[model samples]
Target: MVRMFVNGQAMSGGSIHAPLTDARFLGRAWTAPRYRFWSFRDEFPGLEPVSTDGWSVPGELYAVSYAVLRERLLPLEPPELELAVIELADGSGSLSMRVRAEALAGAVEIRHPDGWHGHLATRQPG
Candidate 1:
């Protein structure tokens, strides 16, 4: 199993969580305060590592089998995202998705202390 950090729809109760049905949820985790969070057309969250002035993004960690990672999760990812290693708040590395540099042109910066879920909360219709 490999550790995977997910900050968006792959989390619990999310639309894209089916792929992880067999994976082990490892509870909540945070990214090291060295990345910026983004939303590409409000479709998915993206992570961009920054040199300075970053914020911790809330997310979840899971122990996923190689088959799940390759055959299930990855195929659902958008073209704008690519798998990359990211540092957790505890300084541990885990595989996560980062926005491709080329895709930034269409991204909108998002600053929510609670991360993707928080952003989604605000977008709900009253």
Candidate 2:
């Protein structure tokens, strides 16, 4: 099983979480403070690795089979995002999604303290 980090729709209770229902959830995890979290039209979130200014993004970790990664998970990913290896807060590596460099042209960079979920909360109308 490969450790996969999911910060967007594939996360638990997220729109695309159906594919991961049978996967073993490791736990909540954070990325190393070397990524820029972005929202693509608020449709989905993406992580961009940066060398200097970056933030730790929160997400869930799961142990999934290769088949799930290639079949269930990957195919559902947006074209603007790509698969990449990222460092976790614990200094370990995991498979995560990062925004394609070219795709950041109009994406909004998220600066909320809570990262993805925080951004989502702000989007909710009360």
User: Pairing residues by index, what is the TM-score of model 1?
Assistant: 0.96
Q: Write the per-residue lDDT of candidate 1 for residues 1-126, one digit (tens) a residue.
A: 999999998999888899998899998999999999998877799999998988999999999998999999999999999999999999999999999888899687889888998997888899
CA RMSD of each candidate after superposition:
0.8, 0.8
Q: Model 2 Cα RMSD, Å? A: 0.8
- Superposed by TM-score, candidate 1 places the C-alpha of residue 27 at a distance from the truth, in angstroms, of 0.8
lDDT, residue 18, model 1: 95
TM-score against native, each model: 0.96, 0.97
**What is the Cα-based lDDT of residue 112 in candidate 1?**
87
lDDT of 2 by residue, 1-126 (tens): 999999988998888888899999999999999999999988899999999999889999999999988999899999999999999999999999999989999899998977777898999999
Pairs of colliding residues, candidate 2: none
